[model samples]
Target chain A: MYVAVKGGERAIDNAHAWLAEDRRGDTTVAELSVPQIREQLALAVNRVMAEGSLYDPDLAALAIKQARGDLIEAVFLIRAYRTTLPRFGTSIPVDTARMRVDRRISATFKDLPGGQILGPTFDYTHRLLDFKLAAEGAPLAPTPQAAPDMAPVPHVTALLDRDELIEATPDTGEAPPDLTRQPLELPANRALRLQALARADEGFILSLAYSTQRGYGRTHAFVGELRIGAVAVELEIPELGFAITIGEMTLTECETVNQFKGSRTEPPQFTRGYGLVLGQCERKSIAMSLVDRALRWKELGEDFTGAPAQDEEFVLSHADNVQATGFLEHIKLPHYVDFQAELELVRRLRAEALAQTQPSPRAAAE
Target chain B: MSIMDRQNWMGLLARARPADLAALLPDLPQSQWLRPPEVGAVMVQGRTGGSGAPFHLGEITVTRCSLQLTCGTVGHAHVQGRDRDHAHRAALVDALMQTGAAADLQARILAPLARIETDARAARAGRAQATKVDFFTLVRGEDA
Candidate 1:
């Protein structure tokens, strides 16, 4: 007879202790500092903040270090930390128009007012590995010039707006419903859906956005403009009588001009899909905008083709990696008790089938 | 004055030098703890192009303190990052501002911070403007 296994608690404790040792991994070289992660591995930190939905660089850095550079795990850490926080108040919407832009580019316009300020981008770099980087002191060719004098750049979409060629966005001061406060329901409003997509896993959103390009819910989109920069945040305090700038944060904004089919009620005009994310997350922002446009098919009077991107419920529900990973990885836990019952039933059924196939012993002897 | 203006001045007061507020209200107010000074996080939300639908950007660490003064004025302060003392000071200033003493507080504390914030913003903008570029195209003779 097999007895139920015990002492799992002690084994689990020992395993965790061993995991801590393994995580350090030959500590002779040097230990990673939070500042090093924050400054050096900044892109990772940005992704963690974007998906984790937490903006603090220091905490994101620490989470990255704790998770051993696993971005999804780092995001999970941030999400767990955020759940414990007390919300004091909501800030006034940040003004991106007043953003001190670092990198601004438009696909539609060649000669924009501000011109193209390609701030630190890898768009033109060759992908070959440099052996010199493995050694000390790699030299780089430098380009020098007098700093260009330019004016404040206007958004490319605004040019379209001048001719009334784009969809109108009205300024309604209605407070958007909070996604965190209530359970998610199907057919989520635009605000709630956007909230879900902003923190959605980048890879998942990217794939869905990619599917749209491959004729799944196809909508031809042109990048109207994409900008990355810092914007000041202001908050309203009733006692003070006016809004005040509290701080500044870096953000990535993407606007997509999509070709929309017009109905009898409206003339054919270019529609827009927008994305705004924390830090310089250009890829996520672009993917988010594409998906954002795909989700708006119903509102724009476009027929739903039953595409993955068009299914808001499916996309929002599965976009969170933490929830997905938990459900997926939970199957590894013990299921022996359930299996044992199935084992007995199968054995009995096999024996019965064997008896049915052959005659009884007395009948066979006769 | 309007709540928006009052909030603006209070934000300045909260972020300004603690010494300035300490000098004005040296003694801490005799108030009961409505919500004790605690460090927490708030999920920051952002809107597309500053005017469209809202989305969750991320959460930031914030220290919040709330208290009720003996005279029935309630004050609250929520500041980014974990600074308990700053939150406490801000909360005290908030409660006092609600009372008739707001005018004194604004003139003494808010003015300096407002100037500091404005100057800092202008300096940043100046540095960014130095790198701005303008592009022009040359005319070609064959275009007839």
Candidate 2:
């Protein structure tokens, strides 16, 4: 006998109202404005923009506020909103080589053409909670520094390429598949895999990259270069007979030089794994490069050892935390009918077993 | 001019000093908005390293404005970030530049901005040159 539980509709409505109230908290303190989130909580906005694949700071800030600072949820809001908008035409590739770099470092060389710059980073910051931030005080302004020279800083990989030590990346002229538009298929190409890793959940990618470092996929890597800066984005307007610089964005680009074994036709060479992420997401970008290197095993003629990072289908499918979370949490809803059917089957089986185990009273007398 | 050169000029014009532009044209033609200045985003794409199949890098905020002069020349300006006034001024200049009326003001308005941009670039280059390094290793006796 199964009785369906009723009155969930009203309960849910009340819960939602309570949730709204909770989100408001004490209205005595001033409510957080979108500009404050956009400006003050910039890193959160950056993460949402990066993961959501939309670059609007105001919307991201609003999403952050609506999601109560849960960055993943904020990303989800932005992602949902993005689907409603139409995409304009694609712009020409940004020139990072000409980037007015804020922070640039190369591990392969002790000193490079443009010297290493250690910009604003939390690397050496003490993790102490600042009580001053609790009480409202005007934030201190940053001292301005002179702009970086307008010159192309050669990539560290270019030095290795001179001796044919690194693999050359040639332009294929074919449009790479957009993972957002198409269903992810198995044995995806490099471009598609890169796209997946780009907007893939940062924490998920980090763990996979960490797994590789622990000898799961084991591609020894050196940080060839890590650059954080503003790059110009140019767009072509055929009607205008020229392309124009539309905007600039802050990006973190990481390149990993990994060891590759020689094959029949090719000599042993250091292969490259590239990652370019939005904002100053150093850890995510570095992790993305490691995962990228691990995924290149097939193309580089290395045998797959069934590692998590090496599995294309696994990484690409599970990388989206939104999908993973929804599927994992959906089991909490409505299973009463299913359980009732199982209950009936079990009761019938128990009765049959009891009848078989003990003889009836009439049979025993006979 | 090559597209690259023209782009450079447009960039200069977009960032030109407002006072200088105003001084160049004391009395400007009244222009009506075709598309008023609005903030939006432009998705930025990039190659792996200057040469590879294109990949999505990220998005940057942009303000685009379009205006038409009374003489019917329409011009558009799409500049980076959220400066509505800059976008509008650039659009006006673009409209004026397309018309025959721009002949006298082009040099008067743009030359100073161009010089400033060039000087800024040179100064930046000089500062970076101060940090330029040349690395060399000493050979040990045994190796030699």
In candidate 2, residue A109 scores what lDDT?
Answer: 77
Model 1 Cα lDDT, one tens digit per residue, A244-296: 55456788889999996677887889988888888889998889989999999
Q: Candidate 2 i-RMS (Å)? A: 3.8
Model 2 lDDT per residue over A46-160, tens place: 8888888777677889999999888888888887876764454577877777877666777777877777665666766798998888877868775444554666777788788
Model 2 pairs whose backbones collide:
none
lDDT string, candidate 1, B1-144, tens digits: 666665665567555655555655567768888889898765566775445656556666767777899999887776666667777888887788888887887776666567776665555445455444466677878874
- Per-model DockQ against the true two-chain complex: 0.29, 0.33
Consecutive 10-residue window with the lowest summed lDDT within model 2 chain A? A142-151
